[model samples]
Target: MSKKHKSEHHEEHADESWLIPYADLLTLLLALFIVLFAMSTTDSKKFEEMSKAFNIAFNSGSGVLDNTTIVTTGEQMSKERENNRQPSKEDLTKEQLQAAMKQEQEDLEKLKKQIDNYIKTAGLTTQLETKLNQSQLMITISDNALFPSGSAQIKPEARSLALTIATMLNKYPGYEIVVSGHTDNEPISTAEFESNWDLSSSRAIRFMDILLSSKKLDPKLFSAIGYGEYRPVDSNANALGRSKNRRVEVSIIRKFTDPDKSQNIPATPK
Candidate 1:
């Protein structure tokens, strides 16, 4: 009877062995839930560490989860901020730039017309000429109109002419005016000027000074240059050619434009 009781006890314990694996499965499920809950609350860096621990415990050196996209909360926030950094296009639209350019063109044309009319009325067309190009509107004046032979000083009779020109220039504000002087190939040496370069430069500066004497014009918008005899419009072989070469040029430059540059300017910062 004692031997029979031992056999029945051993058999009862054999079925109870299944409970060990069941308890292990329940523990694994609980760990999985805890890992998932932690991942939802923490950053990706911490989550990766926890995942490694769980994988080592449950998977026995194998991976329990597959590799996937793992962006941190901080990383996600940074990405969102970057997306919002683009400039707004409302303040500097393309239409606004085009309108501004059009207005500038109209102002330039009006100023040219006024100058042209003045030249015609004064009967100075023979001595003065105007040329318009992509870069500037140039008013060319013969040297004889403003000075005597080898003299850098403006003629006393030309004072009225200078005043008239200054008055006309005063009508246009905020424009860059360049006064450039050119001379004939004939060399000149006198008590005042030693060479053509000196003569031309002095003439340019003298003319510019007169133009800036008007209170309505800004001195900062004017500059003087001298080309001497190097930049001549005609050959120096004859009197007429030499006459055309000795001239003063007043140039009014276009505002903020380049014909070769792209017209589609970016309205806002990139």
Candidate 2:
């Protein structure tokens, strides 16, 4: 009986039998993970094949990186460079034209003095006023000096102003010339003109005609405009303002200098 008890104790102390199946399950799980890891490390062709196969089997899109398509580094960089390109041909041309126009404005200061000197020497300072602006050398003549109060016919004395102006303008044949007419806010009614617009335009045309008929000037380089009472240099609320507004302006188209100019040179007549 004691020997039978010892056998039973030995059998009870033996390693538990459940360890066999538990070890087998662990081995199978480890093998499965290893296989999956191996599959994930495939080349492009194999990866595509697997992706398509999975998508078909699962009834879904390709099962790789969601919806992203991987691209080479060079290809990505080339695409980025293309997208960052600037200024089309037309845009560049427009920019160049605008730059040229702005350059012309810088040279107008000197041109004004030339006009002023002509005014002083020709004894036209009182009748033809000198004004310097960013883009024009305006020689303004009062209506009383150029014409009667309500007429476009220029006075005989006004010919001196036009003749000297034509001489100066002839020196710079490339400069564009504009004769513009301005007026006060007061209404006008005449046989030749019904409103300020007609009067202003007629005056501009008359002045342009005088300049064109000059033997020294180039008619091709001139034009005329009529800004009736709108573009005033000052408010039209007082007598001085009204008188200022009622004048004719002859503008010499400005020229450009170097972009780096720090000071103005004297207005030299060519």
lDDT tens digits by residue: candidate 2, 1-270: 999999988888867789866765554454344335436653445445444443442454333334233223225545755787754424446557457555444445555667788778877666677766544677888888888888899888777677767766776666778899999888998788899888888898887887877777877778888889888877889998888888888988665433445444334345
Ten residues in a row with the worst lDDT in model 1? 62-71
**Worst lDDT window (10 residues) for model 2?**
65-74
Residue 71, model 2: lDDT of: 26
lDDT of 2: 0.69
In model 1, residue pairs whose N, Cα or C atoms come closer than 3 Å (at least 3 residues apart or on different chains), thus clashing, are none
C-alpha lDDT (0 to 100) for residue 65 of candidate 1: 35
Candidate 1: C-alpha lDDT:
0.76
After superposing candidate 2 on the true structure, give the runs of residues whose Cα lies further than 4 Å from its correct spot: 1-111, 255-270
What are the lDDT scores of the predictions, listed in order? Answer: 0.76, 0.69
- In candidate 2, position 101 carries an lDDT of 51
Per-prediction tally of clashes: 0, 0
lDDT of 1 by residue, 1-270 (tens): 999999988887545778767766765675587578657753566567657656654865323333222234335646766786643324446776456556666666677778889889989889988876656778999999998878889988776776777898787776789999999999998889999999999999988888877878888889999899999999999999999999999998866453555543223232
